[model samples]
Target: MVDANVMKKTFTVPEIKPLDQYDFNRAKVCASVRWLLAKSYGSAENVPADLREPVLIGQELQAGVSVLLLSPDLYWRAHSQLHLRGVSQGPGQGPGGVSKGPGQGPGGVSQGVVQGGDHVALLQLLASRGHAPRDQDRPVTVEDLQHTPIKTRAHLALIDALMSLAAMETVGRVKMAAEAEQIGGGSPWENALLFWVNRLNQRLRESTEDDDDKTQTCTDLQPAQPAIRYRKDKVQSKLTPTFPLVSGVKDLSNGCAIAAVLHYYCPSRLPLEDVCLKDTMSVADSLYNLQLIRTFCCGTLQGCCPLAVEDLLYAPPTLHMPLGC
Candidate 1:
């Protein structure tokens, strides 16, 4: 069974002062992006020392590898929200019509392997930042995160890792196909990449199935509830399924987080699968624009250096929000 208290506590919009709370606003995030791009182009420490040798010597090489690296962090933030905030009701509800489980259960681990890596990385980074509790720092609080900057190099490193992983998979898969003339010469890198890609795809598909089963169980077992808040405004007004404890902040973030998991696990490869980038972009935009989500992003940025919520929000081909702003 899901913990109602945890959901009630985490799902609500964390109270925060407006611009004062977040160190890096929209502009600072943008600048950090340029810095990342410069590092990537210059080959000036963009790729982690630990990962560089493997990446350079890999079987399938990608022209722009940073994209893969970024994915893990993005998915981590998204998955963390999903993990923390279980769906209350409506479209994202679980099987027994009860709240979704917190840890690994029917609806858990839906995020992909790469995303899992990001979750681990995020915790390590947070621990280094002091946001993560130590033996001395027993309790965790928003105040602990208040002064920290959202932007950090670690986030950029994470993005690069995700982009690299995806690229490695794509290139590996591409190399596996034998042309009429080159049928005899097998590419080793291609085979290796295919091995992992196939595994990832299968795992993600199964996770989706698990989610479906949970959803079915919830709907079948529980009776539907009444709407809590209704208003004329399209944006502010509540639609249905008024669970008293769960706040709007928690509800929306949970939806966005689930959507993020779906996105990371099921990214549509260009010239391969037609995963709608536009749709994903729209979701990212809407989530960042929300005051609550922006605050959460800012919170995640706490103690991190050189990376900010703005960087994620304004990435080109994503939002295309102006850099100077």
Candidate 2:
């Protein structure tokens, strides 16, 4: 089924514009990129018709991949509160033994030797997660992403790929909380989420304390309150999701919960005047809330990944976040 909500998320109220095709309108793309650049130090570099600035885009993609790779593991470790990767062989040779060469001196323990290019790493990440690109599709090179704007349904597919990846890690713990059941939850779908949540919330506490935010965790459900609506609808908006229970997935979907979380940690990123705690059924309002959340993630949070507005709007259902991480 075609989702009509594509390209709708914006800082302002979403207008539900009809798409001529799948790609983002150049005007919108240019505007957002320019805004991203403007925030950086030095004069904002205007993105010309040729989106020729490859370095930043490449770096950003690499950064996003790294964030995705690391956060789930961090969540897990925080939940466990112990070094789960402890070697059965003990410290034996120790963690990193410098390679001693016969002819020369020690090859001083190889520090920070991260392999794989960002392009390959991103594709591999997607492939590993079952979001592999199609064989019929042409490969997207730096040239294609930077110099040549896509001209078919490719852009839409690409956006789907990104949206598939961006839901968790960067935006806030809220998205992770929503999908908590999937990440730390066991294989084939099951509590890893709550386990992770308890850990993360604890890690976030004043001290390196325990994750005790049960009411807010996904495992436990909250009640029908005017503060949160089950769904973004007009007629049935007030209805309680799952009646007896509602996880963070539905309760925090509008992005308001994320805003509240950000305000506590990074007040400067989201001003109090900008935050609206009340439940909002408007698509634009929801996207704006997510925009604010994404802004905080990409800017204030350390090691936080970046995601497109489309990604925030169309986040995929949570899945196992690769235990082999």
Maximum-lDDT candidate: 2
Please, what are the lDDT tens digits per residue for candidate 1 over residues 39-76? 33222243344433322332222223334333443334
User: At residue 230, what lDDT does model 2 achieve?
Assistant: 22
- Superposed by TM-score, candidate 2 places the C-alpha of residue 188 at a distance from the truth, in angstroms, of 9.6
User: What's model 2's lDDT at 216?
Assistant: 43
Give the poorly placed runs of model 2, Cα more than 4 Å off.
1-252, 267-273, 318-325
lDDT of 2 by residue, 58-152 (tens): 22322332232232221111111111123122222211122222332211112222111234444454565555444247654323332322322
| Deviation of model 2 at 159, angstroms | 17
C-alpha lDDT of candidate 1 relative to the true structure = 0.31
